[model samples]
Target: MKYFGTDGIRGEYGGEHVNEAFFEGLGAAVSAHLQGKIKGRLPKIAIAGDTRFSSEPLKAAFCKGLRGVEVADFGVVPTPALAFGVLKEKADFGVMITASHNPYTDNGIKFFDENARKASDEAQEQIEKFFDEKISGSGAEASVKKVDMKSHYIAKMGSILPKGCLKGLKIALDCANGATAGISGEVLRGYGAEVVEIGISPDGKNINCNIGSEHPEALARLVKDSGAFIGLAHDGDGDRLVVCDENANKIAGECVMGLIAIEASRQNALKGGAIVTTIQSNVGMDESLKKRGVEVFRSGVGDRLVMRLMLEKGCEIGGENSGHYIFMDISPCGDGLAAAVKLLSTLLCLKIKVSEMSGVVSLYPSIQKALKVARKTPISETPTLSKTVEKIEREMSGNGRVLIRYSGTENKIRLLVEGKDSALNEKSMAELVKSVENDLQ
Candidate 1:
């Protein structure tokens, strides 16, 4: 909690905690950590970022902190690209600068290990501890050089997708005016799809502004109006994905995972016959997979936690409901463009539409509410709320579920209720919300 969150160290750009001085310290900490791992050799660190105006300055400060380290500055690339480059270059690690789907006013910094995995909790803690220490560089001025990784990345993807797999498919894409602006379209075109791109232009201020996976309704409208066969929208950092059918009906991330599972099963590619998801995922996904004899594993929320379970369970796929997906067989981190290509390939191979394929999972009606609270108290310490939640669970029994937890980034408590009956779910949610408010607000 000192410097990281469910995602990363995110705050308002230019704020006290997220400004130049902080990132400079963070950079030095990262350099020292990686240096310790390599035992005094020059550590190589790759960095990339989204299109936010603050990204460049923060990145500069971070690199300046790494005066003695070898920096591969992948200018203005997606978060996944940085992860991929880290592994491809055999660097010690990498960093991504962007607040993901958060508003443009915010920014963040996250690291990936040499294997492209999220930095472990222990590693993050070490970085925080070192932030206060003054570490000398290599006695030379910092010089961050740019690297181009798009061609190599696209070629790797090309090998996985069948030749001309997307031929004649009119695909619509919403790049969210962020990292994937020009990158995603080129990949789809290379696969032989007629790409209809929106949110392709970024003015450094409009990333995810009423666009991207957080607001797929806009892309759905574009899909319907443009008469495209399918639509894909990505969050600002190009790590999340949301899709729409030809009719423009949006498909939830879990539903899309279900569709992928079916294909993987048919091809005997579903390792361990298991899938991993977060507790936030709809229980309907579990029920739907049960019929196919596929086991479901739940981890704490966050893509990092989801991947942890996947690695332990030997599953080939895992993701969150927020559209952050990991096809572990392809990449360690989430890549929205990779997910889009896989979906397209599956459709071609199955000769089915997105609407029909997505129907593989039937979900119960659910409601999610994030209530702003003045403070965050441990749920165990809030007796009133705990008792109320227990009573609600007893009443629901086999009919529904209740999950309440605090947000890591903000002073908010997220409440989710899913049930066989919408009215019952709503009633239970209201009671839980009030209980939480009374105890924490």
Candidate 2:
């Protein structure tokens, strides 16, 4: 079976695939690698989790297996906080037990390094291979400890913002009632933004209950009615972001990534003026940025792939159309709050509304549709699917682009279309999405 997908392993809580035995096995395998290689006194690892009901239990199971790794337990923290905790303590690795934007029934673990960055594929591959072992060194090791995982993250998170940066700025934030619920308000407070927070309280069951970036109507209405300058909405684990302007009109999530990319380049934070993203990214971005000589690097669908392309290109910012944005120059893992803060800061520096800033590069119309498959089967293994994809590719060439790929986090196939013509895009999108739905759904 497959343990590592595009991002990480996720399955239903209390299910056979993600039960206690598997989690412990995974931990033991990964820890065995560090035991001999890492020359540290006490092998330490940081831990964190989201507000999913299953996350707490899974985290407990995971930490029990990663014994001897200086374990710190950050309660109901977002994915970024977990990664940040690892970076702050200067540990060998960190593990955050979260499914990240998936519904409440789903839960999984994502690992990061001491730098708060996602673990390299090579390291992850090695761990995957070892997970099949019957026995490992850390399995019988001793010394399990659990400490607070929030303070260090708060300190490091606070370090990046300038003093009084948001002193008089008015903003509204929707925490998605998930991972970043507790910390989102406090972090904004540190910057002194007059932050009006929604979805700040999460009982384990209430994670993404119609209250996230996925459902922005609530936040949008609140932002417009409150006369707020901006609005930021985060997903379950706060790894992705979405935003709105003063009028509560959404700045397309893809536009958020593009805005940051342009800003990073202008600020010299992005090296060589190259930005890495995926084919699913809006065509408008590529068209607009090319005029300015800003390079757009394309990668496979997944935050991990975008991140890899970013490093390979030595670019600071990378992301996808799905809202997953990475700032290699800032944090290793995608941090929604960090991205929000940067976008807010960019607004501060430019003194422009989000709509005004986005007008610099207009987004082209594109269509994206996902079809859920009945079972988990790698798209590469389906010959019929492959042929259908080829047919779509042939039909869309020159006039537009079509991307067919399996979603990293779900049992679904995604069809993306983008081009110069709106009618062609919608027609192709409907055709492909319908075909895929019929074939696989």
Candidate 3:
């Protein structure tokens, strides 16, 4: 927990845990942990990174820590591609250097097991234990080789949609100047769509700067101005997606998920007749899916938990409101490009506009806010905050909901209030925010 966050180990570049020296030690620790798992032969690791300037140095330092391992270096690929590479190359594990949607000034690392799944909590805890012990290398150098993972990834993604499925569509794509900058454009173009691209040029420092999924105003404008059928924006590491309609309206992530679920149900392909989402997802999506006889299950925030629940429930699809969509049938991890292709395929088959698809779910009015905290006191231990939440829930009279939790990756508390009345939701959120601040103080 000291180094890992909600998704992985992330912080400002050059900070205590993000710097090269610590990465070198982390690499050694990871290697030590793997050595205990694999009995014979050197474990092979597939490593990739995003566009952050510091990623290269950190990757080198980590690679140096591996003792007698074979390294398949897939330079400048998306996080999901590195996971796919892990399976394609039959590697024992995968490592990706990225800070996901974070700014260029930050970077981090994520680990995937041979199953192409995020390292389990148990695996991460063992690695952390090794890191604390300052594990040293066995003095055997890693055999490094450059692998063409991009070509394989592109081929697989491009094949997701039927040939010529996008023959007449004009699609606007913003890659956040990150890992998907080069790859996503190619796949869409190959499918016969005319692609309008921005945020595709990465200068290392420009990634996620006023572009990408985190900031999608530019993509919306591009969709309207270019007369594009739709717009797709990806986060720095290409594990998240944000879509805009032809009218330049950003479709909510929940609506997108609902649209996909409806289509899958129509085709009798929705596994277990269910889908999984995070607690942060709007209740409207659940209502919409329920009308179509599809069940919705909620999990804690984070795609890792969502995926776990999906497996448990035998669901093939799951996502977060923040744009992480996991298609268990395609890949174990969330993949922005794969999600885009799946949605496009649905659109083409249904012959509906992106805006029309969004209309499938009507979201309830909600207000969400995040407040910086001096400390992360457990919410259960904060009596005042707990009482306020209970009071607000009672006031909503089962017509609304309240969710409050500390951010897993930052020193902040996130709060949300959802109800039928927008005005009441706003008032309740203000009161809740005030309560949180007072309790923290």
Candidate 4:
């Protein structure tokens, strides 16, 4: 927990833990931990990275720490591609050098087991233990091989939908100038859709800057101008997505997930007749899915937790409101391209306009805010904030909810107030924010 966050180990590049020295040590630590798990042969690791300038150097440092291991370098690919490569190669583990939606100034490491699932908390703890020890290598250099994982990943994505399912349709895309730059556009065009793209040019420094899922204003404009049927925006490392309809209206992730859940349920394709989502997801989605006889399971706020709950419930699909959707039938990890393909296929089958898809769920009025703090104080320890939250819940009288928690990845607090009355929700949120700020101060 000291190094790992909600998703992975991330921080500003060149920071204490994100620098080359730490990465080299981490590489050695990971290698050491895997040694005990494998049998005869040496451990193997599949590695890939996004388009950040720091990615290459960081990767080299990580590779240096591996002793007597086979390393496959998939080179500047999306995080999901690295996961896929791990499964295809049957490697002991995989590593992706990225910070996802973070700016180019930040970088991080994500680990996957041979099954292509994100490294669980237990696995990370074992690795951290090894990281604390200065273990010497056997002096046998790591055998590094450069593999072409993009072609295989592209082929897999292109095969998801029926051939030419997107024929004559125009699709707008924003790749965030990161991992999906070349790949997403190529896959969409191959599906017979006329693809218009932006944020596809990665200059290393420009990734996630005023573009991507985190910034969909530009993509919305593009969708309107191009007359595209829908607009898909992917974050820096291509694991997250944001969507907009032809009219340039942005669609919430909850609505997107509801639409997919309903369609999958109708086709009897939804495993366990359920989907796993996070607590952060809107209650409207849960209510809508319930009406259609599809159960919604809520987990903590992370794709890894969502996936874990999905496995527990025997569900085939799970996702977060942040646009990280997982389809166990396709890939263990969230894939933006894969999610986009699923959404398109669902819309095509339903024969509904993207704009009209919003009717699938009617979201309650909500006000959300994030406040940066010098430190993360536990909400339970903050009497003022706790009292304010309880009072707000009592006033709402079960018609709404209040959520307050510190971000697992950043030094900040996130607050959410949702209710039937928009005015009450807004007022309650302001009071909550004031209480949180005062407590922290």
Candidate 5:
């Protein structure tokens, strides 16, 4: 009886959880769950992955499970391309092998629906159930085969580029040398930009070593030196994008939200004139959108939540401070390449400069720290942490915010604080985190 985490199956790169046996079950279960519908036609599946070493094995295992099911293997592809392929080929579903921005040692599987959105909770449960009871005993004869992931993905992304000219734009792109190294540069070319692409070469080991959304300082420095209009960085799976403006100043994800929301609203793409983000977003972002007469909607931190609110409110654009932007106008799931294109297009049309929007959302000075703790520890499960957090929230009322949550994939408790006063928030955060750690230990 294997347990599935919040998203999908995940664990160490080569850990027991992601082994061949699990893959075979996962494949067969997913296939069987979808078999009833496929009776009307051949069930089509698409698969892609980041540069993680576990990619091939997992892909192989998944394919093995889909014994009679048809699958198109888009090798070493990004998350967005997997969605594009599914919708382009009109397949039943798509699977992506990635841990997003997690360290290289960790990996995961992301599922996308037939409409190119992240899979729903019900679907995820079904997949896990299948993994719990695998159908095939032998994966060697699995009928899954390979397809040209690059060519199809490129064409699909290219079709979405805004019809215009980016002739004067000089952009530096850091692909994290993971999944996006291939599509980002070529697609920007289709839009007529002068693109200087770095980290496009993936060695499988350097997926997000020191680049991408998790760290854009390097990209910012390069953008300043290169004198490009903007520097774009993506996480390992290509689901999130962080930007650096012309002056080499890093633009946080939430700020980009204000920028994209403003432009989308101006362009009449902001349906219901609303933008969605997690509760952890900067106060400046919500305030900025309100000033522009657009609504700021709050959701849980997961992209799944942001997407749900987007669909519910029909929001044209929504994203996270983590750099994952889910543009409902494009697709339900976050697409780093799509966000890049949309942002670049909007900036070009505005003609003011990326630096201008830099001042749009002023993030509250905040800090997030985590300590490795046992998943079964009292601190995480005990009511004491919640009680302390509530007290902190009340004490810092109208001054700061506090958030405590367990990582869906890791054995750690995260402490997050955001406030208008940096010093106060910093001290408060430190004191609280330390107390929790000490008590738990």
Candidate 6:
């Protein structure tokens, strides 16, 4: 809770808190914590990183502090690959160095337990406590071995869909010049799709620069110009995805999940006939799924919380609105490439193009505002804002909803209001933004 954010520990690379010394200390503390948690057994950690100039040095420094631990180094891989490698290698856990959609100057570290899922909050707290205690080690005798998971990950994803499932289909991919720069194309092509690649040339600083899921406009244009059947984009870590239909219409992850829920319902594959998503997801998804005899459950704003609820609620699909779709039927964590493959497979199976399928779910009007705050005062501590939120919810009376929370990675508070009536929703959102500023100021 102290060091980890909604997803992981992220900050500007080379900053005082993110530099080599800090990571080295983190490495020692995490190794100690994991060792204890795993019953005094020697923890075998699978460490992987994305394409950032600072990643390699940080990883080396972190591993340096591991001392005598067995570290399997997966050189330059996606975050999901690191998660999958944890299971594939049967390691005690996994560590990934990436900042997801953050800018190139920023970097992060995410941990996955042996189950190939995000480390539990309690586990993260334990690691943080050890870090604060400043565990000491000789920084020597750490066993760092290199392992290649690219091909293995590719094979596993391909096995999910039928053989030659994407034959004769064309898809465009923007890999964000990060983890999936060269890997996504290889995997998609291996699955028989004609792949057009962009953002594949990573020069360290170019990762996530005007490309990837955060910026899908360029990818949309490419998809339309190249006449590709669909376009998919991934963030820096290749853990989240943004897609474009054949008509260059951008599709949010909520809509993607809705469409998938429909398909799953048709095949009687919807686990417990429910879908899990985040509070940030659109209300339209809820209404659409309800019509299809599926229920939608909301979790906190991270894939970790989504997955946590999925397990608890017996739901098979869960994801955030920021293109982090978790097809629990396939992968444990949010995987851009895996989701794209499944989307393609769905398209082929239904004999429909992305453009035609995009209309399956209509998103309601939603507005989001991010207000700068000097500090992250807990919502409960701000009685005025908390009460206002409750009052607004009462006014909505189940017609819509509101979510206000401080961002885990940024010094700001986000306010989201959604409903069927666009005009009323906008007015309500403006009032909520004012309340956030007043309360947090």
Models 1 onward score TM values of 0.96, 0.91, 0.97, 0.98, 0.92, 0.93
Clashing pairs in 1: none
Model 4, span 139-199: residue lDDT tens: 4878999999999999988988878879999999999999999999999999999999999
Number of the top-ranking candidate, with TM-score as the measure:
4
Ranking by TM-score: 4, 3, 1, 6, 5, 2
Q: Could you tell me which 10 consecutive residues in candidate 2 have the lowest summed lDDT?
A: 134-143
For candidate 5, give the lDDT of residue 153: 70
Q: What is the C-alpha RMSD of each candidate to the true structure, in Å?
A: 1.7, 2.5, 1.3, 1.0, 2.6, 2.3
Model 4 alpha-carbon drift over 4 Å, by segment? 136-139
Q: Each candidate's lDDT (Cα)?
A: 0.86, 0.76, 0.91, 0.91, 0.78, 0.85
lDDT of 3 at 71: 96
How many residue pairs clash in all the candidates, one count each?
0, 2, 0, 0, 0, 0
User: What is the total number of backbone clashes in candidate 6?
Assistant: 0
TM-score of 2: 0.91
Q: Give the alpha carbon lDDT tens digit for every residue of 1-441 in model 1.
A: 676999888889988678999998888888778777786468888898899999999999888787567888888888888888998889888899999998999999988999999989988988888886665344344557788876677677777776777888899899999999988888888888899989989999999999999889889989998999999999999998999999999887888887788778889988989889999999999999889888889999988899889999999888888788899878898888878877887787788888886568888889999998987888778968888888878888888888888887767899999888899888888888888878988
Predict model 2's lDDT versus the native: 0.76
Q: So what's the TM-score on candidate 6?
A: 0.93
Error of 1 at 366 (Å): 1.2
On TM-score, the stronger of 2 and 6 is 6
What are the per-residue Cα lDDT tens digits for candidate 2 across 43-108?
677777888878777776766666445565667677877776776667788787877777788888
Q: What would the C-alpha RMSD of candidate 5 be, to one decimal place?
A: 2.6
